[model samples]
Target: MSDTETHARTQAQPRPSDAGATDAGPIQTGTAPEAGRQLPTNDELTVHYPCKYVPVELLAGFGAGCWPCTYEAHSFEEADQLAHPNLCGYGKSLLAYAMQPDVRVLVLTSCCDVMRRVYDVLRDAGAVDFLWLVDLPHLRGPREVARFRGELRRLADAFAAWSGRAFDLDRALASFVPPVPRVDDRVTLLGAHGPLSLVDTCRDELSLPVENGTCTGWRLVQTPPPTLGRAPHEGSCHVCQDGCEAGIPRGDDLDHFLDWYAGALLNQMPCMRMVDSKARAKLVGAPGQHGVIYHTMKFCDYYGFEYLEAAKESKVPMLKIETDGTRQSAGQLRTRLKAFDETLHGMAEAHEVVTRRRGADGGPTYVLGVDSGSTSTDAVIMDGNERIVASVIVATGAKASRGAQNAIGQVLERAGLREGDLTLRVATGYGREAIPDMDSAITEITCHARGAHFLAPDARTVIDIGGQDSKVIHLDEAGGVLNFVMNDKCAAGTGRFLEATARAMELSMEEFCRVGLEWKRDVKISNMCTVFAESEVVSLVADDTPIADIVHGLDMSVASKTAALAKRVKAEPAYLMTGGVAQNVGVVRALEAVLGSSVATHEDSQLCGAIGAALLGLESLN
Candidate 1:
């Protein structure tokens, strides 16, 4: 069998890790580095790079060239303080190890707004000498390349300036290659939009040798566009062309030599905001367009914005995946990839077909999926033919046990079936642990990906906006979760944020959605924090800004924030939008406008997780 056929035939087996194991690790315990690379301890400053006086070995170690400093921690009071409240947990842990008198330069990348502040913390706290701030470009297209390349060059120069050493280009490139293949011979590139742990889990489950270039400080090697920037070739390699063209946007002051000196050489021009008709035209010329495009929820604005147009222009197949930093979508990811590969290889018995139900001998399949969420428990039941039988949503009311029982009872009662009559019961979401009665629990990440795939099997990306949190997942062809990103620390850009804003505005959720749809003029809301956003809205109302416009602005703000988060993890789209936010037409419209693609949301969109969980229960029973 061909490599493609063999992979396609492989069942998308899923192995979920124990709860809490996702966050706890040898890296967290401060043992050996997870990647076999470790920074110096407090008394081991002599072994660090950009050293005041470096021994040669420190300079030669892999991953030793750049030091990453996160902003979650700052030793404002005591350098020796092991822990500090208000500091980010990851940041604090990094700082605790970083301040061990390990004298060295640090490389910082502005992955988020907090990252920008990290530099200030380092500078103000007297923790850094040679600080290289790698400015991040917006998740836009090829315009971002220049900024990224320039930032990388700045970092390189900093390395030379501090240690009088330059990067060996050949050696740097070689470091990216795998040292030796693991025995599994299954190498997986788990593309994600957020942190490394999610990818790590996927690698572990599949026993695949993995390379995490996304998390490491290593930069993407830039490839120049074709001479004269030839028009998009419809027959060219789509991934290579699109990837190459996906550069950072140029700065406003390209002529200003002085502005180029600061890391923000792009002059604050959003990378995706560039006028690149030439690139687009050339991209459209590529032959046999992209095989798949994966987008995260909320963060789909940039990639999602470009995808439909790009797909139209390139005529490529596309997909979407969603996640919340947790690698809970492996099964769905495997499925998506399999389907995509099969379709690409022309081996699929049926060309890509997405339907609510497919099995024969049934009006509908009465399967049940239960999503035990943080704020509520939901249940969705489908017949053998995938027709909806009963769907139930109820307040969890702090008693997940009672809440789940109530939801399941309601759905079962409505379906006129006893609990045992259901063919399957799948459970999902953060509160998976709260329900011991579940036949089996699937992660929300996997469930969301599966649900999105069920709705749009071609979807390579999914964004789920729930009450307390939000996530963007990337999937392969079979709707298996390949990778994911999540919002962990704050409630901004989530359904909870919308709820708070609605309450503060003294508008019902329905009213809030209506107000946004009626907006006549654009008003921008700058803050994403719930409290700050509410304050901004209050001031806008006081200032007599039209309520409709203010509401519109709020929706736009949420879209922008989600888009930003999704970009960090490298989002693409056959975009699927899920969670409660998918039901809010106002926010959905705002997101669709911002992304320039109509998001896929079904009448049962809000019940996707529950549906997925119910499906998983069937798989487990089998």
Candidate 2:
């Protein structure tokens, strides 16, 4: 199995890395301003705008260029340390990126409270030389259009004064380029303004074509009238046209240009802030759209409501993912996208891979599957008849590759088999890419669904709470993945949570599990954050709270979170629990209580992922 890392970088914009800035100079102005604070003094101004309403062509009318500043930060070290803890990750990321020296100027739109707060923080700190917040009206009416026209004219004049250059109206008018609609099957990224990095991830993971259909992607401003010093037939390509009777907008001419510019900005597909949002249907209902990958930011609730509605109404496949807009969720992001891709393509592609590459002869053949997770590595071997012959589990240790080698060696030896004896070897889990001697790799989500069906045919919902992440997978009647949901990027409801609390209580994991079931009273854990949970546990222990009660409380905490995830996927009865956490009887009982149903756990629960991998590989081959 290979390590779960970033599938792709934020597309287009060069997001600054911790190693060093790739944006060296004028050509690439996204570099972070360091302690030396070397601000650019040249006339070639660099501008970053997160909103689509900001007129980059207008900015170019003077001298400045533009960069769309919507990318997840590597970390919020500087932001969390200095900015408000409650601020959303996207706002924090924008604040952090604005601090870079390369971002000398920013033309921010007053889109939301968070954006206004960002402007405040930047203004107070003097983060950039030129910081301006353009006021946007909520409604697109005649009066609002007139108001926005004046706002644009003022902004143009202010920029003209700052850069010591005249506003080239013709140049600004020429910047009005239109977009063409796609006709081929593709995955449309809907909901919330996400960074280019997210779009890049969707493109890399999914089998079909992917495009950002979010608010930013809908920059559908029309070209102005040719009489207003603008060329026609610019089309979708934004190709420049020569031989035009173009001239600067002067007197009444200037007023007319401003009117068109303001109306165009307001008339474009409205964002959540706008009143007429009926046009948003185009985002998901676009032509040739196969599926929708909806992204929402943590604590951002507006788009979440829309996503919920879309999930119920839309006929196409839907995958809803959320993040703090940081690289911390990178691993889980890859896992979800990979599984979503599997869902989009269905079982045909999977069966094709096995048959086309290698299948078993009509004879005795041993197929192997390896699951390398963050905490442990598991391996399972199956014969031609799909009977489990042997299985082994080992600590993942320092390197996932080493742990995989150890697990593979032990399972092969137990089955009395060699490397060449196996007909096919499939790997799954976080470290699937790192494991050596693997013919194919499948996501644990898909593997878990197959494994759960194999273990308990009656199960419709599979709750797999592993070392670092937890997921609720919904399977169809025929053991195919129908839908799924994952928790936030935290260690609240996983094995890691139990492990940490056990360590704090000075009890072994086994003892902790035993004591949890012995509780007489229902102790409540307030917070689900790992660090805070541990602190609450310590306080409870100091208050002379019974150890059994505290242990049960932790179990309940995990159960509550897992139940929420299951509810998102509309999970049904006959639930199956897998992964290492399935060994904990206390958690199993707690989940049963929270879910108001029984949760079945098999002896080989930890090996379910590996078993599923082997079964899938066999099915693919034969």
Candidate 3:
């Protein structure tokens, strides 16, 4: 071993006194553990594998513990420094685990190109005591099984040499167990190997039983081959000329056991990398599944195609989400998962969103809908007759709670009422939870679809461009949300993007609105990134480009991106532009041109979220 390898070993391997490998948490195999079952301990060494295909039982026979290398990184600084910046987020996260000071062993398959590069980087860095890249084969026929068996044997030998331990065939056979079937209703997480934190978040956000059915989460291998192990003289092994002693397979017995083990690992539920992986759809839409939460890692192509296929063929509702495996995306992920939970439960079960307290004297009951957004807080007061009696919009400053209070107070006063007069106050928006005294907090996606239907009865699609995010919602004939897509992680193609450009041009948003319509020449602003687009605006200003034309370009950029999102959800005509951006006539015109259809807007477009919230709240009272 090289000096670097020796150093890595000293830093990583646990001493005899140490407990088993650091707990990577439960693997979330969608089944509860068997009652009173015990797992073997490997205090000396822990072998970590990042994929489901890893043969944990084989490693156990060598007295090495096995754990799923599902580390979600605080940041990608270490991985980014060592590897390309554009590596898939899953690979980056794995690299973070490998580079940890105490990572003794890591095993990864050539599941994707990025992962192969990850192996290369780790090999050069000598980051762990033992790093092995299993040469995964796409096919699982007899030939492939034989090839995989050889690889498994090679791995067993290498690990034995590294740990200075002999493989005990009985221990390996003992580790094998058939997967307990999960038959209960569940929300299945499909697609890529998601971080363990993602599973925890699902449990937190969802009311249903959460199952991590992703490529890494669900690992099922057949129990010891019928021919192989017989407890203490029950039968003699066919391969062992001498009867198997203490159930430890030797010579041909070991080979026979490995052949079965290899087939089990290869022929089990295949991942996207495998040729017959499309058959893995059996994992989804299981009996009593509430829905599927399909996750895709950024820049990883393996799962996205499968996600599309699953979404198309799904019998139950499916929510597709993408993450870059960083803590920064946590808030966005929470919002998406929470909203998805509402869609599955609220829509599927026809659950009532109950609102409390109407007037005892049968006076006009009123519900207040408050949308506490980043830029502005909007409140709408609706009476029992579905009439919007009063509305207010207030600039949300440092605190969303304060802005919500201000909007609620002003709207109540405008309606000649006090807070006591309100029957229900439903909150919607990113800041919904930050507000106080809300009867209930609902997602903006659900609210917007409801509000758009009420505001424009003919509309089948709703386009909402808010300060921090943009969303395109597809609605059914009754204004129920069928599907929605959001660009929440980045400020691009949002109201914030235009605001930054307007500031760069030293113009107020009001001026930006009118000036954009007066453009004489069309300019293409290719960059959609907020910071880069603002720099582009500054450069245009430096070149003395007309402010009207520059503003028009910015509007066109936003419109183009919004149109693309609309296409993803298979949007139809009769579109209603809601949220704060609808007030900007420039964006409306640009959108109309790009969509090749009239994008209708209402005077109360900014209050759509609040209106929707109020409508949903009133439904409970009815």
Clashes (N, CA, C under 3 Å) per candidate: 82, 12, 0
Residue-level lDDT of model 1, residues 1-622, one tens digit each, is 2222211111111111110111111222212222433433222223222111111111222123322221222333442253334444334434443454443445545644434455566665656444445666544344565556555455544444444333332232322321222222232231223233434443443322333322221122122123212333333333454355444332222112112222222332122333442332322223322333343323224334555464444444444445432234544454444434433343222122222332334433567778887777899887655666888999888777788888989999988987766665666776665775555555676677667877788888788888878888777888765555677547899888998888878899889888788989999898899999889888888899988898888889888877765664456777788888888888888877777777777877888888766655444433
The TM-score values for the models, in the order shown, are 0.51, 0.86, 0.87
Model 3 agreement with the true structure over 456-557: per-residue lDDT tens digits:
999999999999899998888988776778898799988889889999998999999999999999999989999999999999999999999999999999
| TM-score, cand. 3 vs. native | 0.87
lDDT-wise, the better of 1 and 3 is: 3
Model 2 CA RMSD to the hidden true structure, in angstroms: 7.5
User: How would you encode candidate 2's per-residue C-alpha lDDT over 1-622 as one tens digit per residue?
Assistant: 0122111111232222211121222332233443555554444456788887887767755545567887778877887766788998788999889877677788899888899999998987878877889999999999998898888888877765555555566656655554443536777787787787887888888888787767555465666777667422222222333332344222443455676778977777778878787767656655567788998888788788888877877877789988787877777788889888887777436422344333344557778999999899999999878899999999999999999999999999999988877888889998998987688889888888888889999889999998988999998887788889876477888999889999999999999989999999999999888888889999999999999999999999999999999987889988999988999999999999999999999998889899989988888866
Off by over 4 Å in 2: 1-43, 80-82, 226-252, 275-278, 348-363
List the candidate 1 regions with Cα displacement exceeding 4 Å: 1-94, 98-366, 399-402, 456-461, 473-485, 563-576, 616-622
Instruction: Report the Cα lDDT for candidate 3.
Output: 0.79
Worst 10 residues of 2 by lDDT: 1-10
How many Å off is the CA of 168 in candidate 1?
A: 29
Alpha-carbon local distance difference test for all models: 0.53, 0.79, 0.79
